[model samples]
Target: MAVNNMAVQGKFITFEGSEGCGKSTQSKLLLEYLKAKGLDVQLIREPGGVAISEKIRSLLLDKANAVMNKECETLLYMAARAQLVEEVIIPRLTNGVILLCDRFLDSTLAYQGYGCGVPVEGIRSMGLFAAKGIQPDLTILLDLDVEEGLLRRGAERDRIELRSLDYHNRVRKGYLDMARKEPARMMVIDGSQAKDVIFTQMCARVEQLLS
Candidate 1:
């Protein structure tokens, strides 16, 4: 199976970016596009897609859990990921299902590792345990300015969203840095562009993998 790049196996494609980067929206569009093409595909949002993982997601995003430590937050994300990988990702990929995910390990690297002051190397090292050594074949990143991105989110932000602007800026930089390091695996798209334009670019990239 192709673990790191696009190949003929069950392709795991993840959409990543800051809070309002439109990763979720565009991922859904890609999901519908693939379905319309009669492809076997499904979409899974991180910290979700499974019963156990969803519970962890609740705790992770709850504003009441404001006292959650960076280390605690990091492990919780991993715990949720471990459940998700075991329950959703591994089996589907093994069955040759094209999985379109809203977020994955990259979010942890950006949010906790960079935004929360945890070490990037540590996040990568721990990610193996959570992801079970199965990584994305393609990672599509929706990049945009931190301020504009947060503005797009509007009110009713979650715990992570309520963090300081500096933290979010660090997270954004982390994503760009990761994308820069692995140009072949991660594709960067301008989130500020129109949805159709972004979807077109995303579709062209995905078609190459499907072909």
Candidate 2:
């Protein structure tokens, strides 16, 4: 599907936030909205877009792997991302698909760097290599309180989601910190708002980019 606007190049938009912050829902809504507008769009998630990445994602999220070390976890995430970028992301973007990602490099920075006590600089350095220099044109960060987000998850929690409140708080702070540093590229939105309200804000921002 070719886009009508020649001015609108392939845009990489990422959604970032802690668990249960509704990034997935918002990204999906954006994807549908763009498609309805006759835009060539694709929605994918981090650590599990392609076959290899999906395999890695299973390992990463399995509650059985509770004892996985922080360094190993970080490297595994990077490995999955590298595979995804080479196999799925680059080709889709080159073909002019408006790519909407549920999470991306920022997840590694927030999860491993802040939540797991890894060095932020180190994660960024490794992320650059993994992502092959592909940065999001716009990143929508859903800011939500740690406790509220956890409560929203209730019983079904993945390995990452089962982490302590302190860890989740660190992750949330890391996301906000990154947004502050890159205000132009990252839009911080309140996740506690109504779903329609959140989507409205997202659509408004994305329309600006498309226009």
Question: What TM-score would every model get versus the actual structure?
Answer: 0.96, 0.94
Local distance difference test values of all predictions, in order: 0.91, 0.90
Model 2 bad stretches (over 4 Å)? 1-9
RMSD values for the candidates in order, in angstroms, are 2.3, 3.8
Candidate 1 lDDT tens digits, 36-145: 98989999999878999999999999999999999999999999999998888887997889999999999999999989889989999899877868888899999999
Tens-digit lDDT track of model 2 for 61-151: 9999989999999999999999998888777887778999989999999999988889999999898788777888999999999888888
Give the least accurate 10-residue stretch of model 2, judged by summed lDDT.
Answer: 1-10
